[model samples]
Target: MRVVIIGAGLVGTSIAANLAADNDVIVVEDDPDRADQLQFDLDILSILGDGTSLATLQEAEVDDADMFIACTGDDRTNLVACGTAKTLGDPFTIARVKSAEYLRTWQRKHGAFGADHLVCSDLLTAENIVRVTGLPAAIDLDPFADGLVHMAEFEITADSPVASQTVAEADRFKSLTFAGLFRDGSVLIPGGETRIEAGDRAVVIGSPASVRGFSNDLNPSTTPDKADDIVIAGGSEIGYHTARLLEERESKSRLIERDETRARELAEELSGTVVMHQDATDVDFLSREHVDEADIVIATMPSDERNLLVAVLAKRLGVDRVIAVVNNDEYVTLFEEIGIDVAVNPRGVTAEEITRFSFESVAENLSVLENDQAEVLELELDSDSSMVGYTIRELDSELSGQFVVGALTRGGTLITPRGDTTLEAGDHVIIFVETSFADEIIARA
Candidate 1:
């Protein structure tokens, strides 16, 4: 695939890095230094010019692009670039915008910017926070197959039931499979004898009910005493989106904003939410409002430093979890080291989604787990597959260490593989493998 990306900032550069491994990528940046740095770091063609200009788009050869992405951190620039690219190439176009209103306008008017996809990093980041709110122990969680299937990651605690047990013995759930385990900085396709140890991150695939049970077992503290209360600092975009999503969960949520006008706007926009016009970092205001009782506190101030301080204060006020939306990637580790529960990078979140959509797959879906240590692929078997007529045992032998078949779907039914189960062509197969071996399975299945 030939991808032309119009930005060299964090999100665009990250997307380029992920795609350049298997695709021909061309990046255009007005800043010469960033473009040259990307060229030195990755095998990609770089154009040093303003991406919104027709000359720059022509110089980047938009006509040869299979996909054109505009993510220059400016909505006007991104929309103009996508419009220019679409006029020239008619390729699949994606524009990253900051405002939800612009995205709606694009969708309502047959793509107002000629962009096939509109990505709002703030909304994406907020949605990510909402997905994991009730999942305390989950390192990550993603759903597929119309919510029938789920891929989740859990960290093994020493006292957990699955911690000292082998893969075969960790059978708390009837409809779940341990897909892959990450330990000692290495990815492992666990077998029957692979013993799960403390600090190991285990990835699993299973039905929603089964995965939910396993998630609680992995982290017992997740079970809520009553309805969870949410306290959000700053009426930022992420704060508004998070509160809006938590409403569906029926949680009691509150938003604190220093600006009176924004507070009024948020109060009118969000129902069943308490909007407080005050400084969230102020101890007196937080104490007076009983912020300590919140189950989760999300810090979404404009600056990373302010968010970090808010998170620290929330923790000090007895909040169980503090999720910080950070702009600077370098501050992520620092936030974690200082005891923030979760540090989210809007760029990383958006980049992952864009990279996931950029793929051409024969499978139903592909989800990479644990920072690309492993990947879960949902594919269908065909007559050309090597394991078409083989039993589970034989198929396992054929796959060897490359991958593990996690589940099989025949017709509309799900099958947990046994040694004697025979796999036939046209059956749906879910396999989990080390990320390094994903392409091999993609080729065969």
Candidate 2:
């Protein structure tokens, strides 16, 4: 497919690099230096021009492109680029918008504009943080339909009640499907007699209500209380954004910063949260602040070494959860081995989001499932689509190993569809597919 990507920043270049291996990619950038850098880095076609200008887009031959993605850091520029692309081409357009207000108002006023999809980086990042931190016991979660349903990954600790129970005997997860179990780094598609042992990671899928119910059953005495006392060890953009998210959730958080002015500015912006002007690595200052009492400690300082030190200190100080934001992927396994509850690499997360968005079909948004083996894709049925008039059973038999119809959204209602259920035009089908076969499945559908 021919794809045109606007902006040559980190996000745009990352997305272009990921897609270039499989598609014809052209990156547009107004900055000559950045464009040259991206071209050199990724070996992709580069167009030096402003994305918001129609002439630049036309010069880039957007009309011949299969997809046009506006991913400039500036939200206004991205929106305008998307709008311009819609007017000039038949390509599926996507825009990256960071502000919540713009996303809320964008489609309501213009009805999808020329863009086929919208990516909200702030919301995505916030959601990713919440998924990892909100429930420390769960390793990951895949939210569907904006969080109404979820597929969650939980590690079986030695304390878990179902540690030694068989699938049938593990009454804890009654309504949820024990999708698969990972033990010794291999997946076991469990059967009724399959037994779960300690240290195994279980993948379960169900609605939020059912999944939470199952979690409660597994740990009956566990509290549903949200984290209140949070200690953030940086005031960078990502750190500030994370703190803002926590504050919005009514969580009490404090930012510890070495820079006095930046700390003061953050404190001003976040009136409810406390801001401390101190080095987060200072043991005396941390002790004075009672950092040990914090429910969670997040280290987002720019220096990876400092963040790692702070995380280790927080863990030693008895903080229930410690999360460090590190730039190096190589350090992720090392940090996890040392008991950091979570290590987030913003670049990796951002890259994953971009890759997921890049594969989105015009009729559906492609989301990566948390298990890392599959994807949850939503496909809108068109009148002439092959499966539109077919029953679920027929469709299942016709499709290959690539996909499985997980659920159907019809007339705004979600249904765990059965083989007898028939699909109709305009119905949205949620299919779980292996990434390797996603394109083939989509093409056939």
Candidate 3:
């Protein structure tokens, strides 16, 4: 497949890097320095020109490209590029936007922007943040099969119940499967004898209830009951979305904004959430509001420095978990090293979401595992595809443990896979597959 990606930012560059190995990738970056650097570093072609320009599109050969993706920071630029590609070529169009308003416009009427898919970064970032709210020490979280199946990654601490146990021993959860483990910065496809070491990231696949239980058991310190008080600093889109989600759950949440007008607007938008127009970094204001009583503190401010400072201040005030929105991917590790419980990278998250559209099949939804080592895919079984009319126990040896079915949905009901469970046509199956064998699974599907 020949892919044309615009922006050459984190999202575009990453998609190019990932697809260059298997498909033809061309990147358009207006920044000459970044374009030159990418051209020198990557195997894909890079163009240093405005993406929305027709000449630039012609240079990138959009007419022959299989897919055109616009990921520039400007939503108008991305949409215009997609519309241009649509008007000029026969390629699939995808544009990344930060707001849902533009996406809604495209949805209300078909062919509005010539984009087949709209990837909203702010909404995706908010959804990701909300998923990790109650889960303990969850480095990543994804739901499949209509939320019946869950895939999550959590660190194994010394005190964790399954820290030192082998995969077989840790397979005590009735419906949970140990998908993989990350140790020494390498992904390990776990086997029966794969001993889980302390500090390793244990990835698991199971029903939502089972995964939630496992997370609580693995990190007993941050129990759901204890991790109740939620404090949100910054009235950004992410902050509003996070607080809105918590409002629906009836969670005790407080949002702080420095601007009076924005604070008033947030108060009107959010119900059951306390909105305060106070400087989050002011020691007196934070003390007056009992910052030490906060169990979770999320800093969603625009500035990285401000977010980091708020996170540090909240931690110093005895906040158990501090989540910071770090726009730069390089700052993710640094934020975690500096004691932030979780570092949310909107750019990286958006990049991963867009990249999955390329690898994920037409009938499948992809959820990447830790470090892109694997992906959990949910797809409906058709008569023409392989692996139909086979019971869980009847799977061939090569297809058995390498990938495990987490759950199945038939007739609007979810069924946790067992040895006796058989898959039929039209049944949606969620399976955990190693990244190395994704192509094989896709082939079978």
Candidate 4:
């Protein structure tokens, strides 16, 4: 596949880096330093010019590109670049936009703005926040097989019942598979004898019921119920969408906006939300509002620093979980290091969404994990697949790739992968594999 990505920003760079290994990647950047740096860092070709300019697109050979991604930070620039790319070539165009309005417009009319697919950063981040809230103990959660299967990452806290148990002992859930473990920045493909430690991040794939049951088993006290309170600090676009999405789930949230006008607008727009026009940083106001007693507190402040502060404050106030929206990619680690339960990065979310399209025809879905060290992919097997009709254990021994079949969905039923489980055609298998072996595994399967 030939990919031409514009902007060379965090999102564009991430996509290019992920694709450069398996596909021909060309990046167009307005900044010479960024373009040159990308070229130096990756094997991708870099074109230093305006992406929206026809001459620059020509220089990048966009006409021959199989995929054209416009991921500039600015919405107009991304849309314009995608529109320009359409005129140059029939490549699949993807645009990253900050506005939900653009996504809605594109959804209403496919191919609008010349973008075949549109990723809305704020909406994606908000959806991410809601997914985390659904599983408070999960560091990350993604659905597969049309929501029939769920892949979740959970930190095995010191108090967790399964913290000191072996993988075999921890495999109590009927429809859940312990996919992998992350410890000390390394990915571990665990075996039955593998012991789960306190700080190990365990990745599991299973049915929704099984995942939720596992979450409750890990953190029963923090699991939210229908009556639990969710407080959202800030009235930014992400915050508003978060509240709205929560409302859609029949979870009413209290939204704090320092700006009175915005608060009134939100209150008027969101019938289920309680909009409070007050500073989220005000400790006295938080105490009076009982924010400390909330089950979940989300910090979606405009700035990363403010969101960090709000998250820290929420934690100090004894909130069960604190999720913060991190605008800058560099701040994600810092936010998590300082004890925020989850740091949702919009750019990262957008990048992941757009990158999935690269395997749209091959893998049904893909989720990057541990900074690209591993990936969880969902694939539907056909009769032509080499491993069809073979037991998972047999296939594991036959294939050289480092991967584990986490879960399989057949006829809308979740099947926890076991050694004796037989691979069948039309089965949607979700596998956790080393990123290096992802493409090869997909091809072989």
Q: What is the lDDT of residue 11 in candidate 4?
A: 94
In model 2, pairs of residues that clash are none
Error at 290, model 2, angstroms? 2.9
- TM-score each candidate: 0.91, 0.73, 0.89, 0.98
lDDT of all predictions: 0.82, 0.75, 0.83, 0.90
Q: Give each prediction's root-mean-square deviation over alpha carbons.
A: 2.6, 5.4, 2.9, 1.2
Taking the tens digit of each residue's C-alpha lDDT, what string does model 3 give over 214-274?
Answer: 8777776675743578899999988998899888777789999999999999999997899
- Minimal lDDT window, size 10, model 1: 218-227
Candidate 2 local lDDT, 1-445, one digit each (tens): 9999999876787678657877999999999999998889888899999999989999999989888888887888988888898787689888887676677776686536566777776566656766666665566666665554566667677888889999777745423566567687555657669999997877666566666776665665432556768888988766788788887788888999899999989989888789888999998888988999887888988788999999999988888678888766678778877878677765456656767766654435555533245555667778878878899888767766635565666776666666698999988776666655566666656
Backbone clashes under 3 angstroms, per model: 0, 0, 0, 0
Off by over 4 Å in 2: 5-23, 26-63, 69-123, 168-175, 181-191, 197-199, 217-223, 369-372, 382-398, 402-410, 414-428
Candidate 2 structure, TM-score to reference: 0.73
TM-score, cand. 3: 0.89
Error of 2 at 209 (Å): 1.7
Model 1, residue 100: displacement in angstroms? 0.8
Predicted structure 4, TM vs. truth: 0.98
Poorest 10 consecutive residues by lDDT, candidate 2: 363-372
Q: Evaluate residue 79 in candidate 1 and report its C-alpha lDDT on the 0 to 100 scale.
A: 92
Candidate 1 local Cα displacement, residue 184, angstroms: 3.6
